[model samples]
Target: MMASRILMQRVCCVLVRDLRGSSSYSSSLTASATVQPFLSRTVLRSSCRSVSFNVQDHDDFTERVINSQLPVLIDFHAQWCGPCKILGPRLEKAIAKQKGRIAMAKVDIDEHTDLAIEYGVSAVPTVIAMRGGDVIDQFVGIKDEDQLDSFVEQLIGQ
Candidate 1:
């Protein structure tokens, strides 16, 4: 019964995406060039009015990410991993760019193995975007700012 229900849920998600169509999703994601990424972290951290990005404990991923009132983007990462190191700060930068629009958090797989296993996060930089306890989207591997912008924009449909 549980397996069937889970399968149904997956089907529904796919159906929704197909029905909505990918082009619409893409267009809304990059509607304008308003989301330009900062060229350097130092300048970004220095110049613009700083937007708040909080680093939370691993145990708090569910409380902060899945159940969030605002759309939450979570970077499931580990400390020893090289790609994770590169992606972690990049994820932070992305969050800061659209600070008010999105809530961002991360889970350290080494510290919190359960979240990593539960989410099936086998890779270093698996970013899952969630809203109201449902996963809305995900991005794997290295993503440049424009890609990040579009990925995030897909989650933030008007």
Candidate 2:
């Protein structure tokens, strides 16, 4: 029953995305009803993951990434980019393997254009590793799990 409810909610989310421009109050209400559980589950997972998060704004980025005690990995990506979608989960898995040795900040380039420009991110799926508020290393493109692990290991070892 819960599985079906979740599936139903997923379908609603897709519908909402497609109908975002439409001014339908009923659609909005249906989405609100269906999305609560999905949002709750997402929040629970994010909290449990602990080391991964989405960047909110410039101030948030400065506070979380620049001022972080641990090394931070910044993932600059976009929703419309296919490679960004593929790299995101793989990067999360790689970050998880670190056991909190490092942290990840997911920055949507479209939302945070300033940050992307400041970081010189001309492409999607750019991963930058920073320590002591300084960029230590960066790469632009998709990397295999092994490569990601190696990158994280290097960052942590620094």
Candidate 3:
């Protein structure tokens, strides 16, 4: 019984550390001791339904984007691309604003050369909006948040 209680306290400390990031250890300890179960449920629900995820391969791409029930926004990017780093998160924020009306698929261009070539991606941060397995719209380069939001809205017919 003592060992189990210690383990539970340790788990709570980790949870508070992860959730708050740089939280005071004393406060985290207090919160964890008082509100561990509630915090755990909230964290689980949010993390499980993340809007964006990386495409593992061509088959994964086909399964997720080409056959998705919701319209998909594919971000063709590379790790070394500066613009891609800037745009990827912005695009994700825009997609999240839609509240499950759309989904975002991240594709690493360097890893998926064939997909980049097939899609005619000549630059990093190439965004492709697709529906019904067809390319509905595409643009190459980083777009500002408003432009990204408008692009997404247009695809979902908003």
Candidate 4:
């Protein structure tokens, strides 16, 4: 993939250079016209996997979850929790179905105990939906795919 992308970039550069001499348009405009589609395609490919992410710290949480324009589902879980293991993937799948409509922040309770406490998480696999820094909804324990889907749908609706 990297090789192909590099090759494509080289080809585009050559095309832009050739067009620079053949056309009356400015070289910058010619280069931009040649590169815009490639840039957009790369962005589209990356956006598919940008819906979910792991929380790093309080500051990271604030930046990603609290400040997000899109509604966010904060998954507070622990590595040692059995139910968390079950719900994590199901939550991700549900979020994936929503595409870029919403985002999920996976917070490991053990790593970020302060966040769990602040969010009132008393159990593993606690899913909290937030929009504009305010909590909209939440649930504890594992949920089936249908339930998760409905939960995400409800979040998006709000």
Candidate 5:
């Protein structure tokens, strides 16, 4: 019984260590864990705010992107897409460098299927640039940070 208790303690320690190291653990475990309230408040505060945000719905898209005074860059992506994840941060970084001249809208294909279909997005990580609610430029695939910077510059007519 003593040896079993020691093994259980070791297992608990390993589980705690793994949870602390993982990025998704805060979201997945906080709701059900006893330390939920504290974790939710602290963990949810940290998010990407440099140059873009997750577009919530169709109405939000209309207000935030189409009606925006600034040129908007829309990134159509899916959570399960590996290339989308790779390209997203790079695009954000490029947009951040542009200051307030441009804005970025992120659309998850799984959540916004209609938007994806309307835009004729056949694959993940399709980026479209819009000005005056019209598509000015677009590209599909992973672009390096430098290429993304050039793309943003072109969109803003710099």
Candidate 6:
């Protein structure tokens, strides 16, 4: 679950100009590159339940997530659910905010009920984290981008 330090620097100019009354996008502010952080395996092992964010299909889940090099985050959701709707935009914003470092995927429980059932997703908007495809972290509710970032950083401490 090791990751580089993440910052709130991935916001777009339109977002900044809209939120901060400033159109001037700074290189230090809008940067979205993923830097590989140095982490001792022991340190990473100490923080096992770190959070991750990414998106991939159920079939591709194993190959891209479980087996891929980057950690994975899965958002289990259903379109009819309210919290899922709210979390959806937040995660999209996160995707924009942490462009290259994190990956995010949304699972429609209704469409992929089997995956949901296998993962024991009893609720909508449940987020799960995996390192090398093994279930390593999980949360049962909606998390804003900052909270999500902190959760993941705790594992890899990016």
**lDDT, candidates in the order shown:** 0.66, 0.85, 0.82, 0.84, 0.81, 0.61
Look at candidate 6 and tell me the lDDT of residue 81.
88
TM-score to true structure, per model: 0.61, 0.71, 0.72, 0.72, 0.68, 0.58
Report the C-alpha lDDT of model 5 over 61-93, residue by residue, as the tens digit. 998889988899999999999999999989888
The lDDT of model 3 is 0.82
- Decoy 6 TM-score against native: 0.58
Clash pairs detected, candidate 4: none
How many residue pairs in model 6 have overlapping backbones?
A: 10
RMSD of each: 16.5, 12.0, 9.7, 8.1, 13.5, 14.1
When sorted by TM-score, best at the front, the candidate numbers are 4, 3, 2, 5, 1, 6
Residues 1-158, candidate 4: write the lDDT tens digits.
64465456556555555655775535555467755566446543344336788887899899889999999999998888999999999998999898789999999989999999999999988999999999999999989999999999999998
Better of 2 and 6 by TM-score: 2
Candidate 2 has an lDDT of: 0.85
Query: What would the per-residue lDDT of candidate 3 be over residues 1-158, giving only the tens digit for each residue?
Result: 63464345556556755756764744764666646556555443344335576887888789878999889999999999999999988998999999888999999989999999999998888999999899999999988999998999999993
Higher-ranked by lDDT: 1 or 6 = 1
Worst 10 residues of 6 by lDDT: 1-10
By descending lDDT, how would the candidates be arranged? 2, 4, 3, 5, 1, 6
Worst 10 residues of 4 by lDDT: 40-49
User: RMSD in angstroms, candidate 3?
Assistant: 9.7
Candidate 5: residue pairs that collide: none
